[model samples]
Target chain A: TQLLEQSPQFLSIQEGENLTVYCNSSSVFSSLQWYRQEPGEGPVLLVTVVTGGEVKKLKRLTFQFGDARKDSSLHITAAQPGDTGLYLCAGAGSSYKLIFGSGTRLLVRP
Target chain B: SQTIHQWPATLVQPVGSPLSLECTVEGTSNPNLYWYRQAAGRGLQLLFYSVGIGQISSEVPQNLSASRPQDRQFILSSKKLLLSDSGFYLCASDPGGEKLFFGSGTQLSVL
Candidate 1:
């Protein structure tokens, strides 16, 4: 099985601070997706990176796919209280089934 | 637009009770269906998936089983519930590619 490990399982930061969440694996992936899930709701897709060494920006959030497609990272700048949620990175495996990372729980204090 | 629906937003059942959770997709045909479970503070685990009617694949062997009676409908069941079965269950569907649309989810609490 391909395993994706996320670092800093939990993070708490004041508003306006910057934070980064890392997802790493030994196995290469064809594509990687990032999702944000709030309480009482299913995860919502944030971004999908398909190319190696790719970088995409969504507002204050920046996502990067590793050059080898074995890792990904998410960086949030000037974090706000509304940014608090569980962030998960998933990769497409066999049959296009998603292999999810353990997740990173981030709390941005106002 | 396509949408997926899952019923029983919350359920509390005693151990050894029968379990049934239903999911259906609308506005699509022959879509791939998936069932996933998320334990508290953990990632989502793929439990089962189906590509067509009467075609089901199990990712892990446990107390649960899945069935696809119709092309758009999928069900997750267990003859007898176990305490370890308590968790959040999510149903998702994909048309023919990587993007997956998920349902609201069902929170099962087995006591």
Candidate 2:
């Protein structure tokens, strides 16, 4: 069974602070995706990194896929209260399955 | 617009009771469907997936069973429920970009 490890299972920071969440895996994935889930709601897609060493940005959020495609990270710049939620990293395999990371619960207090 | 719908926003059931949750996709056909379970304040876990009609695949073996009776309809069922089964259930559809569009989700409480 493949596993994805996320750093800092829980995080709390004040507004205007920057935070980064990491997802590392031993197995290589075809692509990696980042999602943010709020309480009582399902996860919503944030971004997807397909190529190794690829970097994608969404406004204040940045995503990177490792050169070996076995790891990824999400960095939030100048975080705000609205950015607080569970950040999840998911990897897709060749067999059409998505392996999800345990998730990082982030709280940005104003 | 493409959308996914899951029923029973919230449920309360006693242990040993039967379980049934439904998920359906609209405005899209022949897409991949998936079922996930989220423990209280945790990430999503892939439980089942369907690529086509009658083709259901399970990722983790547990007390749950999934079926795809139609192209856009998926159902999660269990003959018996356990307290451990209490969680938030989500349904998602893939539109070929490796991104899964998720439904609003269902919160089940097995007392």
Candidate 3:
């Protein structure tokens, strides 16, 4: 089975703090996606990184795909209370399937 | 614009009760459909996926089964429910571009 292991299962930070979440895997993926899910809601797509060594930014959130396509990272700059939620990294698989990571629950205090 | 809808919002049933969760997509045709389950504090588990009508692919072996009778409809059903089946179920549609659009999940509580 393909597994995406995420680091820092839980994170608690104050407003204006920056943090990075890592997702690593032994298998390579065609692309990687980052999603943020609030309580009681399904995950919403944040960004997708297709090319290896690619980097994309959305407002305060930055996503990077590893050169080997086996890992990815999400960096939040100056996180706010609105950023508090479960952050998930998913790798694209064949037949339109996605393999998701365990997730990182971020708590940004204001 | 395309939208995905999953119904019942929340359900509570006794073991051995039949299970039926429906998902439909609007404003799209021939879209890829998917069913996923998320345990509390866990990641999404791919249950089944369908590329077209009457086509379904199972990702894991369990009591659950899925079907796509129409171009834009996907159903997840079970003959018997176990305590392990209690979790948040999500339905998604592939809107091309390798991105998935998810609907509000259904929380199933098996008693």
For this target, which candidate reaches the highest DockQ against the unseen true structure?
3
Better of 2 and 3 by DockQ: 3
lDDT of 2 at A47: 92
Model 1 segments beyond 4 Å from truth? none
Docking class of 1: medium
Which residue pairs does candidate 1 place in steric collision?
none
lDDT of 1 at B55: 92
For model 3 chain B, where is the 10-residue window of minimal lDDT? Answer: B94-103
Alpha-carbon error at B19 in model 1, in Å? Answer: 0.5
Q: Could you tell me how far off, in angstroms, the CA of residue A14 lies in candidate 3 after the best superposition? A: 1.0
TM-scores of the models, in the given order?
Answer: 0.98, 0.97, 0.97
> What is candidate 2's CA lDDT for residue B70?
97
* Residue B91 shift from truth in candidate 1, angstroms: 0.3
> RMSD of model 1, in Å?
0.9
Query: lDDT tens string, model 2, B22-110?
Result: 99999888889999999877778999999999999988889999999999999999999999999999999996756899999999999
RMSD values for the candidates in order, in angstroms, are: 0.9, 1.0, 0.9
Q: Rate the local accuracy (lDDT) of all candidates.
A: 0.92, 0.92, 0.93
Q: For model 2, which pairs clash?
A: none
Chain A only: list TM-scores of all candidates.
0.98, 0.98, 0.98
Superposed model 2: Cα runs more than 4 Å off? none
> Model 2's CAPRI class?
medium
